[model samples]
Target chain A: MIARLRQTVWSGITARVRGTWDSVADAIRPAVPGFGTVRRGHVALVGVGPGAIDLLTLRALRCIEAADVILYDRLVEPEVVALAPRKARRIYVGKEVGAHAWPQPRIDAKIVEEAQKGLRVVRLKSGDPSIFGRVTEELTAVRAAGLAVEVVPGVTAACAAAAHMQLSLTERGVSDTLILTTGTCREGDPLPESALHARPGTNTVFYMSVRQAARIRDGLIARGVPDGARLRIAADVAKPGEQLLHCALRDLPDTLASSSISGCAILMLTWPKEVEALSDPTVATETVAPVSAANAPS
Target chain B: MIARLRQTVWSGITARVRGTWDSVADAIRPAVPGFGTVRRGHVALVGVGPGAIDLLTLRALRCIEAADVILYDRLVEPEVVALAPRKARRIYVGKEVGAHAWPQPRIDAKIVEEAQKGLRVVRLKSGDPSIFGRVTEELTAVRAAGLAVEVVPGVTAACAAAAHMQLSLTERGVSDTLILTTGTCREGDPLPESALHARPGTNTVFYMSVRQAARIRDGLIARGVPDGARLRIAADVAKPGEQLLHCALRDLPDTLASSSISGCAILMLTWPKEVEALSDPTVATETVAPVSAANAPS
Candidate 1:
């Protein structure tokens, strides 16, 4: 009984100590200063969204404005980059097919190098940094150097494309699972066979798949995906020259051939009949005018 | 030759007129007004991000502040809802297990009703609205009523949990595919058998899966997923009292038992040896303090 009483007393003391410690820590914690004046030796991985200035999160904007040096990529819009303070250094380390101005390892090293120089660094990517953004390498490098790191999520291309199209990736009783994948696999590293197949009640979005349209079509067809399945290809999404094409799965290659889609594109596969029927005709007419005109053969 | 020349001249005139019309349209397009002054009868479907107020996008925050009537869900943070203008009407339509404060159809009707009344309606949801936000129903309803609608994407729980963990959903040479799915399948809705299996070089994240831990474990094990696979559970992510637990796949049930996990949680399955090796020990130690303390039995 005495032992149990002693244990209770010790537990009470421990709880009170922890409570006091938490209060002290909360009181002493530093407040986040205004943008353009972040503490040195810290790094913020900010997502700039899908090339639209307004799509940028307030937190991402604050990070960009506060950074002493910002490293950006090709897909990020110039207008979005302009949001950085005039005093901030802007370095374009864009990577295009067959040409990488700055390779991944080099980019990771540079972020760490800048942070170690007592400068606030922002490694900005176009979409949500955690998705296809190669953030783990940079995050690992930064933390290894004992620098503070934070990731700010942004609108990925899939979400932006859906918003621009006024479509939902998942609908109750239609699609419950939304899978976001890329078509551009590394050399000798092919995606799983299951990844190519379109499952029922699930929406599949293929990023960087414009160039591989034929391969995707053949694979899906081999997997028994109906030729009549609907596909939506959005190019330069959310931009002024944005083009959206809705066609059958079998027409994906033909549709690509008809349009000059030589940039980042999102290929969405959804339930054809249900989705098409649900789309508002007025919205479709308004958004599809440019694309329809562009697709007209002279 | 005379006929061809006349045709060319007429086409040139048409092109010039169209160009002039385009320029005028661009000049007269309405600029997005400041928050709290959105045009009436318009509805903005805004994603409020996963619980953190700062994680909200600039567009989302603008929509919330500008809204005349803000309809929010249970998962959205109170601070985020508080961002709405003082005069704005706030209604809670949160969905809890066995208790939906407002049915979906009713919610849709209310949003349409408010919008038709010439009030700026903001339907705020937790995470990117297009993903599992039931946006299609609302979008269809608003468009059917001939009301203006716009969608603003925010950081989903998957992205926020990834950011909090300092892990990337996709990593080159390690994980090329990142699949986001849910564990709470509706009645008569069973997930595909293949989804239970962990693919090589892929990361699978299950949102709202804490209650389904045993089912997930059994399914994955049945699918030949190594019992030693790594599992990370993040509860109340990005909010105060957030808990993160990292354990082997087999230990999922036991680890969950030690924590007070009730609200929204993210279950992340990553490759075991490689991911654990890649995570920085210092960062892990710093972030795991609370979970480690919570897990210690008295």
Candidate 2:
């Protein structure tokens, strides 16, 4: 009986969102009243994708439509922010390129204060919140302020870029593990030693580390990572003028150093099986000659 | 012009589904079609969240409704499978606790073969495909078979479980990073070292390793993880009979050792600050006493 009722409500939501889904009108009529108004104190932290509104999830769209206030960041597109109810107040807490626009405490206070006012605020962010989006902090602060929070997951730029490029982060016997890290940490800290020693089967995703690409490469090499690993840099994934570069780790620093590509890029180090399968056999022969010379114990 | 055309198509779609979304129906028309249809040679890897259909993504729900054939595993609920078009063939490739149903190689072959026939095949997984679902392998195989594949992201078990418990994985300075790793590797390989050392500012998610909780706890302790860190285990999130146990790593083995909680589960290790911020301080001081010893230094 509960299942039947749920089915009705589900269909109702669908029908309410898209007329084509109205074929189940008979199944949806009864559940309409229950979803009338969302409860107050409920917060939806939504990912707005790289910069395109098209990549927004349907739930994210619905949640935004119902918001009373939208606390958005600089990275979110103007078009996507426009989705919030017109009457809903829009607050910008986005950080400037080099400066921290809004401090952490202020953002937390805003969430708590708005939620206290019984507003369903959508804390809009760019890409997936689980990554370096800094959602964990805001959600923590809000919860501490005695409010309810719901995270509506969004597509991360890494996934979007990978999908756009038809590249697999992991492949059988090639790369079986994926590591996501941040490159925004200060200079002296080099790549984490353990991450540097990631098994050959692993792929690493470095977020917000575009300017530090050369350092990241040097750090990885210092940690004993092979110079021959395949590295790809994806910037502005999903944006109209998005850029991507596929090259070897040794050459990546030079390939991207002088390039004008900038802003919130993801650096992916992958051992693609396709490349291994498609590489010119003569290239492998050349690589082995040098590798054997280096490995020949003195 | 393209945006307007897309809006036209979307408005038509929204009108067909929900009639109109409030007074601004004109402003928020469908920019794209609802429930994206799978094209030939394209595999939609979807996650049917825990067991509850309400937790399923609106897009995932539509894909399942329109699937030509659903290749599902044991983790997917029977009710979700029933949602597929009545005429859609349902192939069970799930592995029961002790029974080896269909090996992965066979499943991959079937997906490739079906796609080759131009059938819309949905590899319906229980949780997020990018995580432990091994959708990567399926993606590689299908693409190798000369078919297009698109992964429809779903609510990972960790997020669902966290949502069920109203917990935040990353809370401010308490936890800045969220690392997701399986509890145990197949064939007795050691637990991931990163998961064990879960840094002071990181949250670790363990999937499909509930049975080996004791070993996992031991590994963490050996890695010098602080005893004060917070640990939470949620089994069968969003489903009936869901269970959540928030404790320290050491106490987990004893608490869950004798009991068998099946289905999907998520083990989260978070920083103290994040936990303190997200949890009710009063409730934390009371209910968490028993497991306080979990943080006792090794």
Q: Which pairs of residues have clashing backbones in candidate 1? A: A36-A66, B36-B66
Instruction: Compose the digit string of candidate 1's lDDT tens values, residues A72-156.
Output: 8878887677667678999888777576678778988999999999999998988888988888888889989999999888788
Against the reference, the lDDT scores of all candidates come to: 0.70, 0.61
lDDT of 2 by residue, B1-298 (tens): 4334334443444434333323223332343353233367657787665666545555676677667888987788776686676799999886665686887788899999888889889999776565566676687798788887777655566655654454555443444345566654545444443343343345677777677677777665544444444577788876666788777566777767655676367777764322222212221232111112122111
What share of the reference contacts is kept in model 1? Answer: 0.38
- TM-score (chain B only), all candidates: 0.76, 0.74
Candidate 2: which stretches are off by over 4 Å? A1-38, A48-58, A98-100, A161-177, A185-201, A258-260, A270-298, B1-41, B47-62, B78-83, B162-177, B186-201, B226-229, B258-260, B271-298
What is the DockQ score of candidate 2, to 2 decimals? 0.08
